[model samples]
Target: MILLKKVLLAFFGLCAGGVIAAGVYAFLAIIGVFVRLMGKTGTRKHIFLYETVIILGGVIGNIMDIYEFPIAIGGFTGHLLLGICGLSVGIFVGCLVMSLAETLKALPTISRRIHLAVGLQYLILALAAGKMTGSLLYFWQKMASLG
Candidate 1:
């Protein structure tokens, strides 16, 4: 029956979505994002709030992204909001990358293999600068091409 097929499809889709969500949450937990924040802040009192915001933000962000929602906050306030969002996203991504590298011991292994000593901090700074430069160049080229 047509109704039965639709129901089955919908059920499978929901199950798949649930599985993906669980995997994403597990990844975040394994990366210790929340734990890092708690450790840096020296407070666990707002852990619930932090967790709630992360969950809601993920859901709302996905919904907005999928639906192509237009957030029409124009002018200076909009620019400020955009800047804040950009900085937050950049920081989150930097933290995620560093944590993943640490988990894999990639940087340490590389440094050791290269016999790098007394310049690890400079190497990190150089890597960060290179990433920033590359990101800016990529976006610049994309914008130029668009225009």
Candidate 2:
């Protein structure tokens, strides 16, 4: 009975792998573009600092996502592509933050308010990307199971 249950679950997981990878790729690509465009500089220090935090956090999240999901990433080729996407987006975010941060520092007029709004965007995205990457290679796994 237990053996039968295991086989059934494996079957479903295998079938779902391709769908999951495709879905994840679409999501990551969209979010990456959105994240890249979010680097707006404001006259207020609080807003400046806030946007900086958000961009930096997102870049960090992308990196962590790559590190956290090496297995089940379809194959070496797939993993490499995913990493490239993450790095491209991350670099874009980093450049934005660095440029804006420089502006904030150069300004004499800037807010001193506490800025912690929407700082977890990257963390959440990272977790999601990791899950997608980790769930990939469903087809590969199913094939391996046959051997």
Candidate 3:
């Protein structure tokens, strides 16, 4: 009975993880991240390579996170590596955000749906500003907590 329970738990865990990964990838695809990236860089020929990198990156990231892998890098090399990682993450996030914003066109659509014709531009500007402010506040709080 104990062995059966363990098998069932492992099976369910694997299934759940697969589903979550699929959902995440699907969302990324739907948001046009890959399409936008390739178009911008004229890397249509290298789409397969781009996709493989994304998949491998996800797997390695998950493994490192789940296994709590520790980095032993120190000094200037460590800071340089950290900076590169940060820049890569920032670029990815910016691309993702732009993809989402372009794909959704949410503010304009909402304005049209609600017949809010007059201040639609202001509404979009306000939404963007609000997002920036919220992001700044959240990061500020996170930095405070860390220090």
Top candidate when judged by TM-score against the true structure: 1
Candidate lDDT (C-alpha), each: 0.81, 0.55, 0.82
TM-score of each: 0.77, 0.25, 0.70
Residues 1-147 of candidate 1 have per-residue lDDT tens digits of 999999999899768877898798789789887788788888788889988988898788767866898889876677568668876897788878887787778988989999997798799889989988887777658646745
Q: Give lDDT tens digits, candidate 2, residues 8-119.
A: 9978875675477557546544444334344343334465665576557655666676468554557667656766776666656555554454445632222224343454
Positional deviation of 13 in candidate 2, in angstroms?
35
Question: Candidate 1, clashing residue pairs?
Answer: none
Better of 1 and 3 by TM-score: 1
What is candidate 3's TM-score against the reference?
A: 0.70
Worst 10 residues of 2 by lDDT: 107-116
Which runs of model 2 end up more than 4 angstroms from their true locations?
1-73, 106-147
Report how far residue 28 has shifted in candidate 3, in Å.
Answer: 0.7
Clashing pairs in 3: none
lDDT of 3 by residue, 1-147 (tens): 999999999899878887998899999999999899999999999988998999999888878877898899876687568667865886798779868977888657787799997987687678667876776677658656755
lDDT of 3: 0.82
Selected candidate, larger lDDT, 2 vs 3: 3
Candidate 3: stretches off by over 4 Å: 1-3, 106-147
